[model samples]
Target chain A: MSLEASFADEPAFVPYLAAGDPDYESSLAYVEALARGGADAIELGLPFSEPIAEGSTIQEAIVRALEAGMTVDRYFEFVADLDVDVPLVCMTYYNLIYQYGDEQGPRPFVRKAAEVGLSGFVVPDLPAEEAGPLRDACDEFGLDLVFIVAPTTEGERLERMREQVSGYVYVQARLGTTGARDEVSDYTERSLARIEDWDVPKAVGFGIKSGDHAERIVSAGADGIIVGSALVDIVAEGHENDDATEEVAQRLEDKARELKQGALRGAGDRPRVE
Target chain B: MSTSKFGDYGGQYVPEALMPAIEELTDAYERYVLNNEDGFIDEFRQRMRDFGGRPTPLQYAEQLSARYDTDVYLKREDLLHGGAHKLNNALGQVLLAKYMGKERIIAETGAGQHGTATAMAAAHLDMPCVIYMGETDIARQRPNVFRIRINGAEVNPVTTGRGTLKEAISETMRDWATTVENTHYVIGSVVGPAPFPSMVRDFQALISEEAREQIQEQAGTLPDAVLACAGGGSNTMGTFHHFVDDSAVDLYAVEAGGSSLSVDEEAGVAPNSASLSTGEEGVLHGARTKVLQDTDGQIMESHSVSAGLDYAGVGPELAHLVDSGRVDPVNVDDDVALEAFHRLSQDEGVIPALETAHAFGYLEEHHDELGDTVVVNVSGRGDKDLETVIEETMERDLSIAPDMSIFREVGGGAL
Candidate 1:
């Protein structure tokens, strides 16, 4: 089933994971745990050398993964072992995709992704203006190319993105890079309101840390709630403690469940404009 | 003209949060800089003359020319107000930012020349400025750092990836993504996403424009070739711009050959910062340029005796120029550059920044191959490099004479 179809009944809870964090086997276990913990979709991070949009948490996670010998092909091998029912999307920088394919361009990457049962892509650095090549490649491979809309986006750009985007639109929770914030900014509310009329499935991300943060975003009319740094922080803590693989997986699954429950509380409470 | 491509080289590859700001900059640049509708062009030229000390001399280097057996003329950018050609773009961008109603300015510098120039311009424009520099660069380029702080701008030290120019650029871009509403990013080179490479080249093009006229008036003919060192390719682009269409004139861009381009069998460290000669096509720091990267496309750390030339990538425009055969790319090792640095100082009484010394080093080696008349862009003064030069000279005196075969191994043979 399409990921968008799964969002129709509830505010979908999507948890993000940096691939090969700690190790390949543990990361795969975390994906399954997220699915079992009520994640409607999974956003798997393909580690790049430089992840400018990410704050220190995700940045460290990427560094750890890269040091562990994570590559595009290895990432696919890990994903092939997943048995989850939730849709899985890869979030990465554009350079990886640009260099992934054979001489035929990004088609090889997209083709491999589709063959591996991957749902779509969320490239933060590939803004709508520079997404033509990737978008075309995704189209050829029957995969979705998701684009993001930030608090600073407006006017023709918003409309243009609304028309071009597929799968779902990523609504950034604030004006900054990804990190857990104590409180969600009012800017996210305004951005959500501004784009609510676009008639697209929107997932609010980039600062949604807790169930309360997820509740606030779903209440503000987000079709889905995306959490990244918060989950990665748990995995990082587990690594620091040198916990057993199952123990870390258990902790991540429990947090995913808690955030999913929070998203459910605001499932039908879409904001009504005056 | 609105497109951000130099023959499939440059583009805005930043996050969505920065797209609006990039678009606004593109719009402002088109309206004010390219169109020059509101007398901004005239004001810019007037400021160049009155503030930046423009119409700098086209000096004929008699002693150096005699030594090299060629008619060598120097476009004396070292004599500019800020001691380097950096002020040309700094002053222009700061003015454009003011015209756009931006109250704060941000910049990234490698060797502190661009930071000092930006700080000076910000002080003149009465805007709060912040300059990001790598910790390694800050330690090496201390004098320029002091000059920046004295100019009333905050210097933010970056300690991330490799702690150098590339990391500083990443930090500045991250800062701009959040503070785009009231800030302008005055990039220090002919690199970055869009509008920037084009915009910076347009501002620095004065070097070529003035040199083209001055060389004709002084030497009675256009030079056979123009040479400038390529760090981010700003100085080279400025020096090569006016003569691009002059089919008879050749353009040479020299990059740093750090320790050596060839790997040391015992140490295993290869030469650094020779992106054009030894790098592959990839995207980095916003533009698709030739970058020194590993097989996995990860950006590798670059090395150079000169902080300004220690970058893993070249400007996308220069990458295109290299691919198109319009510009000949050359590499000069640290020892050769040091030799040229001392020779130019002793012969012409003009000390050049280590970065600029690379161009002179190439000319000194290939003088016989160059035509009768040649012009070299003296991009900066060597004041900031005095400490580094002194330290290197002392070290060389203490150690054995270095092997000179690395020069012939990695010189202009590729060209």
Candidate 2:
């Protein structure tokens, strides 16, 4: 199934987690729970050693993932092994994608990802201007290329990104790295308003934590809500506390259901605001 | 307008969040730096003269000249303010930040040389400054950490990814993304995404600008070779910029080879920082450059006796120059660099940083190949490396090393 197809009928709930974080076995169960809990599509973080765009939480998660021996080859194997029905997206630094094949370029990685059932990608460090190589490769492989729109993004660069974005537009609700926050940013509505005209679905990410955060973002006119650190927080707690994998997976399922229901409530109440 | 790519080497590989800031900085770079808008270059030169102590002498090394059988000249960047070439770019960027009305200054440091330089510049400009340093570096480079704090800058230890320059840069980048609206990140090298690599090189190019003029005045010709140690290529580019166009003048970039060029793929560590010597083309620190990485495209942990030259990646422009045959990339191992450190100190009365010592090591090995007049950039002083030197010196029995019987008896650094 296409990644954007999840946003067709209702407000989508997308949760992100680092594959092989703490270890391969536990993380897989956590991700499977998110799918069971109504995740429209899932973003799997292919951990890079230097995650420059990440906040402390996700940075630690990536470090743990790497410590657990997650490599590019292993990440693809993990993807293929997943039994989940929702479309998956690989989010990582541009270097891994650009250096995957022996011939040098993004084609080999794109080809491998397509074979593993990945629907799209979210390379945080690959700006739209330098994305020609990756974009062309994705086009040949029939994979979606998602572009993130920061709150500060606008003008010609914004237009350029919108033109290239395929699966869904990652709408950064604020000017910051990824992490869960106590309060929803005031810029969410403004960021959504600026890109409201784009034909693609907009999935707001960064600083999203709870049901209320998801509800507010979707009500702010987002087609979906992308949460990473919040759900990753549960996984982190599981690893730190050394809780059973099934226990942590159950929490993730409950949290994902809460976020999904919140988005639905927002979608149902959107018309009442007018 | 200066293009971003230098023969398919440099391009902006930063995240979409940082693109606006990068674009804005690019515009500011063009206006103030390139066009000299509002007399930015004039003021920059004046400040460089009065504050930074510009036009550091190009002194002939009498003892070294006799030993090498060639007239060896030293471009004394070590004599500049903060005792390093880093102040040139630090002052330029801090002043530019003021011009852009930025309220805060942020930077990352590996061995604390660039951090101290940036702190001094920010203090002089009366801007708030914060430096991100790896926890490992903070513990090792105490004096420089003290210098940065004394200059009224906060040093936040980044305790991730082996606690080195690489992690510190990632932490600083994360900080810039959130606070880019009001904060200016003063990248310490000519390695990051565009405008940065070009802009930092432009600021540092004054080293060559003066050396080129000084050589013509004193020696009546451009030197046969311009040599400088390559870390992230700030000082190397600065030293080589003017000499690059002079076809007769050879440009050599000396890199840190650590213990050996051989890498441990299982450990994911390159026992060298010679990216230009042995690396693959990949994106690192927001630029497409030659980097020390594994087959999985993971950046490996790079090693060097000199903390400053321990980065896994070289500047894209420097990589391009090496690829196009305009410049040569060579390396010296830790033992050789340590010997060079003592050699220059005893021979020329100059205690060169371990990073700069690599160049002298190369000069010692390849003096016969170089033509008569050679100008070597003394990138920084060695006061900051005293403790590291004492410890490393204890491990190796060097013929050139000074007698440290008392230090050795006390188990290192009691003096």
Candidate 3:
């Protein structure tokens, strides 16, 4: 399915999981589970060694993935083998994208992502100001280039982001890095309001954990909800407990359904806006 | 989008969440640093003198000069407060944070020199400070960790991704992103997104600013060559900034060659911190610079016996300088650096930090090639490196190193 179509009818449920988090086989199964659990789209993390945008939870997940021999080559192989219907976006640092292939630019990575059926990208380190190369490459590949809009982003910077962002704008719900939190940020509603005019689905992420967080974010006028570290927590728990892959996959799938349903319920709660 | 650049090297490559902070920092850097708004530069200089013990000596090394058959001088950054040049930038940043009305300060450190210096600055400035140190570094540099805590700054352990400077930087960036409204991230080196590379260099440029004048007054002319170690290139940039316009003066940035120049691609490890000597153009931390990465474009874990010089990337301005042929990038291996560490202690009656030893090792090899008058930046004192040196020294069979360790492997003998 096209990535844009995922948010066309209703609030989209975008679940993020590091590619090959525990191991290749188990991680692939977990991703397929999320797809089975009604994830409208998925952010497949290409684990960079330095994930500055991540908190401890996702950091540990990336460490585990890197330790499990998850290189870019291996990541592509994992992605190509996965037969999920949802659109997949590669979430990672800009280095992995800029340093890919022989030409020493973003084009090669963008072309490779298109070849691997990646619908878009969410480079945490590549702000809209320096995203020209990747944006042009994504345009050439007919892939979307997503940018995050924080609560602090406003004025000329917001307009620049509005021009470049595509597929979906990942609205950072708080000031901090990506992690799961119990309490919702007071900044999320204001952040959504700041980018309300941008012509794309606004997916609020960072510190989103439960189905309730998902519902509130969607109810706060977000067209989508992105859940990351919470899902990685399950992966970490399963790995730590040495639980069976099927058991972890079952848990991830169930959690995905809960979050997706919560997002749908939030769509019902949103006041009808003209 | 109007961020400063260093010939296409420096730019704001940070996450969008950090753009606002980066913008604010850029504005502050220009207003206070460039324009000297509110006499910020005046106050910063005053504090650097009163608090940081600036104008560290440019001592002429008689023994080294005779041995190398050249006039060798040491720009004694080691004599500075906090035992390193780190205080210059740390105090500058901490003071600037005050001017920006930032209530708190945050920084990252690998070897703990920068952390300790920053902690001291924060204390002197009466600001709450937190330093993110990699768990590995916290264990390796316990003395410095304690030093930071003693200064009343919190030492938060970063436990991810090999637990080193790179991880520490990422952790600190995370903290800054959250608390940017009231907290200022005093980045340890001249790396990261613009105004950091430029601003930190401006703060650190005093090294050259003093050395340049001292050489003229003491030796009657600018030194023919200036040498300094390059890790994240804070010291290197500081040493070379003023000399860039001097066409005749040679600048050499000595990088850690570690165990080998080769990398373990499958394991994603570069057994060296020689990013400027052998690195590809890529973004790391927040700027496009020379970085050590593998075929798949993943940043490889960089290694150096000296924790201070162990980083995957160098500063963007340093990269630009190297690419433009203004600054020469050289390296010395771990054994050579250790030997120099011992030689400087015994020969010159001064023990240099492992990071500083890199420059000495380079000088030992290529002193003849460097012009008659040479000045090396003694980046830091060796007190912090005592444990690391003893451990590394015992493992090597060096001619200069004595039996510093009580417990040594039988075959691995020291002189």
Candidate 4:
């Protein structure tokens, strides 16, 4: 399914997983499980040595995946071979995209993504202001270039960003890096209120973990919710076992199911932001 | 959409959260620092004179000139208040932060010279300071760490990504993104996004300004060339700024070559932080500068005996200058820098920082080809590097000749 189609009826439930965590085959299985569990979209994090936007949890996950020999080409190969129905989005830093074609340009990277059937890209470090090349490349390749709007962004800046963004906007729930918090701050509600007039679809992330957090953000007028570190934590827990593929996949599927249910409940209780 | 650029080398490649902060910083810099309409320039100059010991000496290195058969002058930034050229930028940034009404300051340090300088500035300005330093750097540069603490700044040790300057910068950027409301990130070099490279360079241009006047007064003409070591390239930019418009004066930037410029995969030894020498054009640490990265664009870890000269990427301005053929890039290996470090101390009683020694090393090797008059920026003092210099020199002496003569003579029988 396309990302736009997934967000048509209900609030989208997107689960982020670092690609090739533990192993490629196991990560692919987790993607399949997430798709089966009704994840609207899956954000496959391309492992980078330095992920400045990430907190310790995601940072450790990237390091583990990289140590297990995960490369950008390997990630594309995995995506090409995966049998998942949900649209897959590659989330990473800009350097990976810049270096994908051996410094030629972002064209090769976009072409590879298109060939692999990837739906979009979400580069945390590549802000919309500096996203011309990547946006143009994504446009040429028929891919979405998602832009992030932080709680710190306001008024004219939000409107300006809305114009550049193609896919759903990734709304940050808090002011800090990607990590889980016990409760969502009031800033999310305020930020959502500020951008409620925006025409673009919004997916609140960062510090989002539980189903309740998802419900609150969606109730406050978000079109979707993104859960990353929490899902990665489950994978980390499962990897402690001797043989963890099935167990990890099962846990991921269960978590995706719960978050999807929360999203559905929120969508049912409140009118869609659109 | 292009926030800023030094040719095609710099831009705001940061997260959306930092856009407003960067804009605010740019606006404030344009109004107060650049225009100087608010009397900020006069106040800054007075502070530099009273607190930072401005107009650092431009001493003619008589012994070095006699040995090299050329006139060698040293911009003696080591004699500045904080014992380095770092204070020029640090003092100016701290004052700008004060002008912006920021009560707290954040900075990153490699060898801790910048941290010490920042800490001293913060203490003088009566502001709270937090410094992010690599854990490995904290261990090696103990005196500098102590200096930072004694100057009333908190030192947060970063243990990620090889525990060096790059990691420290990343951590500092992250902190600044979160705490940008009331704190100013005093970037230690001519790197980072937009206004930082330009702002830091403008503040540090005092080095070249003073050196230009002093050199002209001492030599009755502009020097043939100006040389300084390039890590993040602040001192190099400062030393080369005034001379940039003067086409006759040659500019040379010496980068650290560590053990060697060639990477030995078999021995697991990576080439040093010679970005302009061996790196390709790429974005790193918020600027599109020459960076040491693998084919996949993963930033390679840089190696150098001097922590200050160990960075995978250079400043965007220096990258532009190198690309434009306005400034020549040179590489100095660790051994030759070590020799220059000792030579400066014993022969001229001027103990140079390891980073500064790289520039001297370049001069030692190519003084004959250079014009009769040359000015090398001695960017920092070697007091913070005593331990590293002693340890490395002892090891090299033992490996070379097993003779204690050189050590005895240099150490003045203290050993």
Give the TM-score of chain A, superposed on the true chain A, for all candidates in the order listed.
0.96, 0.98, 0.98, 0.95
Q: Of models 1 and 2, which has the larger TM-score? A: 2
Order of models, best TM-score first: 2, 3, 4, 1
Tens digit per residue, CA lDDT, model 3, B1-415 = 4446888798888877788888898899999999999999999988888888888999999999999999999999999998999999999999999999999999999999999999999999999999999999999999999999999999999877789999999889999888888999999999999989999999999999999999999999989999999999999999998999998999999999999999999888999999999998888889989999987778889999999999999999999999999999999999989989988999888889999999999999999899999999999999999878877776677777786554555434532
Tens digits of per-residue lDDT, candidate 2, A182-227, equal 9889889999899878999999999888887788888878999999
What overall lDDT goes with each candidate model? 0.87, 0.93, 0.92, 0.86
Cα lDDT tens digits, model 1, B1-415, are 3379988788888888988898999999999999996888889999999989998899999998898889999999999998999999999999999999998999999999999999999998899999999999998898999999999999999877667898888889888888889999999999889989989999999999999999999999999989999988899899999899998999999999888775332221336789888877888888888887665566777889999998888889999999999999899988888888888888898999999999999998999888999999999999999878766654464232244345446542321
Question: Considering only N, C-alpha and C atoms within 3 Å, which residue pairs clash in candidate 4?
Answer: none
RMSD of 1: 5.0
Interface RMSD of 2: 0.7
How do the residues B237-326 of candidate 2 rate in per-residue lDDT, one tens digit apiece?
999998899999999999999999999988899999999999999999999999999998899999999999989999999999999999
Chain B TM-score for all candidates, comma-separated: 0.94, 0.98, 0.97, 0.95
Model 4 captures what fraction of native contacts?
Answer: 0.59
* DockQ value for model 2: 0.90
Against the true structure, whose lDDT is highest? 2
**What are the per-model DockQ values?**
0.69, 0.90, 0.86, 0.69
3 versus 4: better DockQ goes to: 3
Candidate 4's C-alpha runs over 4 A off are A240-243, A271-274, B1-3, B264-269, B398-415
For candidate 2, what's the TM-score of chain A, rounded to 2 decimals? 0.98
Q: Which has the greatest DockQ? A: 2
